[model samples]
Target: MSEFETTGPERAGPERRPRVCVVGSGWRFTGGLSHYTCRLAGALADRSEVSALLMRRLLPRALYPGRARVGVKTAALDYDERVDVFDGVDWYWLPSLFGALRRLRRNRPDTVVFQWWTGTVAHTYLVLAAAARARGARVVVEFHEVQDTGEIRIPFVAAYTRRVLGALLRRSDAFLVHSEHDRQLLGDLFDLSGRPVTVVPHGPFDHYAVTHRPSPDGVFRLLFFGLIRPYKGLDVLIDAFHRLAPEEVSSFHLTVVGETWEGCTEPIEKIEASPYRDRITLVNRYVSDEEAKAHFAEADALVLPYRRSSASGPLHIAMSNGLPVVLSAVGGLVEAVGEYAGAVLVEPEDVPGLADGLRKARAAAGTRYPDPHTWQRNVEAILGRSAAAAEGGTR
Candidate 1:
């Protein structure tokens, strides 16, 4: 046998790797948080002793493999292994908060990472952070969407989220945000001076660089991929598509991928039954990874006309696949979708603005897409700083 074939796989030389535990809501499939967790775990696995504690409701066997080798301890609420994203991370299913606390205390991780977004895991995070702190473990809280616009009409839930998040933030050792806007929001909302904050841009997927078969014809295909929520501004996209001339409409197509949430389907159904039906394609369901790739492959550009302000994972996915984006200037969308040659920014919730953006995006189609290097560099900087801190180094 060749030397490569004869030798066992090369092992990372041991230097007392720091134990790191990642806590998150769910990790079943290809949503934003799941993708972020998987990527972060993979990146840290190469250098540190990494494990993940996922919620039982979202555990998938397929999603997590090689857990035994990687020391993944999955904690779920049930006995089912129906949800798994990838392998190589340890898992503990249906584990109580107290059980998780005991495990953390026993493992004595060097750092405990928490991923927060919808506030579902808020109480658990607070308890875990306290547990980790008692053991001298550094706590890192990564805010997927921390900015509270204070525009939420639901006062009770908003108030509860604010109170819980404030407590979580105050207890965390370090805060990781996706944009400067989020950093500023953190500073405004909580006492964050003592706990340093770092900005890390979302990274592109590995498959983004894969060779994709282009759409057979040169029709300008506009794609809206992700969960169909009211805030996504689908109404604006529909209005913009409707305003196109007959010939223009015939020459273009809009594909709405992913299912509707938050009563967004009513308007979508109205659009589907209207005169502009033929100009649009509604693949209204949770898009699989393969399906998403095919849609991106067949599209000329991705349109993200969100009404409310927040960062977007779809924008990063689109840009990573070399699909230029036309996005509304709201919250961190502008920061994430920088003014690259392939990006077009427009006013939020303006039908005419979206229409004009569409025109410009179509006009700019076939141009070189934005470089992913910036995202890579930003992620590296964040991880580097985190690693340095873990190793007793300065920022």
Candidate 2:
């Protein structure tokens, strides 16, 4: 409880729920973290008094890759009704920050959880964390990735992030991550001598699984979905598709769906120049929820050949929909989907390995994988409760 607890009526009930405030990027940015914040707030509301403090503006539109579609509603997810929301603090707006502080002061949550994914919100998070700690609220920073791969590529932003993250982490009471790999990476990357770190698996992003509709053209459909980044290894998949046998290439169709980022257009160029150009479909833009649902529904399997990763929302989407997944074995991915019934793990950057995995996915096409993850388990871990207690055993 640390200094966050006060003997009051709110804590007097036999089944008193912890008051928690989850802070993260708002839907205006509309990506993985946005979905996660909404989903997490909903799950936490089941057993805790919850509030969502979101950052409406992540950065200037010119710098964001998907700036053209910023603020467009692309997801079909929202916060739980029981969870109060403050739709958020902006980069240059001092009033928004003050308003967020006021929300914290008024609600007085017992726990303040910050979803850490980028350096853009580091300064704002520091201010909120300091305010929360001063008022006796326990702070938790959940690590989605040690650092954003795109941001880390820049020398100056990376240095600033390193310093700001150190100070922010020093103020936190505990830490939460998606896997043991991430837990080890966090400790190795930061100074967490006395703080606790809990590994809570990422919950399913099943909201996109609206229906099942495999390709009616009789060709095997393979999907590569998400933001197009260099580290995601989309080029490797493109190369592997080209290397397939003529018969296999003729019978297979590859759908590359997602907006380009970090000036990554090599894969797109390769797809355009490939011999089997007609076999590949490139959306080359951010998609709406309906579009995503259609893509997932029509695909035979989902493929993620990330050179490195922490945890992936697309992987969970496939699992939720029972679609076969062909992904690279790297970072937290091995622990995340290795045991799944429909997962085929390939070595990162290996063209032949990926091609083989693709063939395997095609063979298992039309089969579905049962969803194995639950928000209940994720909620219990964040609140530091046992699975038995979450499932109705004595707390």
Candidate 3:
């Protein structure tokens, strides 16, 4: 038997298991970062004493499945939990930054994991991580995407943000990145060498075991799933869909399945008023897990004409459900898409290229998706390395 299995139950002993805490906004809705945190926490919980500090904006039942699966402890803080929309993980809401810090100080976890994406939460996590380090706690920062010099438009703001990010990077003991593109950017932007930065690619759901029948198929279905934002390049997708020939339009239908974050709906509204109005469907609302599964199962292919993105959950979800994807070759997306037998990669913001990708994806539909075990193995290797590093072991 493997070392992990041989020790199995006995490995939970105090000397072996470390106290690990993950501090994040919350997990009441399905964001990529939130989902990533939950998955890691759940996986680690089986091997260590893992807890997550979440903002109180989640349903107790929705957030915490049960204490049986994982020893999940939740504390709710005074905040508009409604504003925090994440699901599938339990969160303890500490209302103010000070309250969060106080809780961390009280818990005194051995290792504190911080999830970072933007500047809004960077300083908050930096303070918490610093406090944890002051208490002799190890801090690890998991970056979904670090703003690149090319993607930053405002010079002064970008510089200031980079400075703040640098401070945070310097404070952490280790780093976790989703893609090689992100790892290179972290190293180049923050000088993050010699520090342990593990690359853990996200995993897809195993759809082969689940018997979910597709929706009645008269209309050709195309789905755009995830938070509707300008950076996601929905406008480019709409334009590309609009430019499709009438015959092609007749053979396909577009479904926009996600809520608008920055209230950017002008482009979508324009599409609604266009000549191909009847060919498109917009379910402009927060999609639940069931709804997401249904959409993926029913769709012919997932279209992600993202203008700028580091990684995508929708693409992973679609691929997991045995559906093919057509995404832009921007950021780490190319790495994630890899040379998968059942996926298509296109250039960023190229409407004709996107349309051609869509055409190709349709032509190559129903092929077997990439093996989920590949992603699982990647995740295992990263987590194992992170744990080993935390324990002062070599990679």
* Per-residue lDDT value at 190 in model 3: 74
**lDDT by residue for model 1 (21-93), tens:** 7676453333566666666665666555666665433333443222221223321212123222222222332
lDDT score for residue 26 of model 2: 97
Say what the RMSD of model 2 is: 3.0
Instruction: Estimate, for each residue in 49-85, the C-alpha lDDT of model 3 and write its tens digit.
Output: 6666654333334332221222232212222321212
lDDT of 2: 0.86
Ranking by lDDT: 2, 1, 3
Q: Is candidate 1 or candidate 3 better by TM-score?
A: 1
Best by lDDT: 2
Instruction: Give per-model TM-scores.
Output: 0.80, 0.94, 0.77
Candidate 3: 10-residue stretch with minimal lDDT: 1-10
Model 1 per-residue lDDT at 211: 55
lDDT of 2 by residue, 1-395 (tens): 32223233344235667888999989998999999899999988988899999999999989899999998888777788999999999977677988999999999887889999999999999999999888878888988988999999999999999999999999987777877788888888898876677776788887877678756777899999999999999999999998898987888999999999999999999999999999999999999888988898888899999999999988998899998899999999888885588999999999999999999998997788888777876677666656333222211
Worst 10 residues of 1 by lDDT: 2-11
Which portions of model 1 miss their true places by more than 4 Å? 1-15, 28-30, 58-95, 147-151, 208-210, 373-395
Off by over 4 Å in 2: 1-15, 387-395
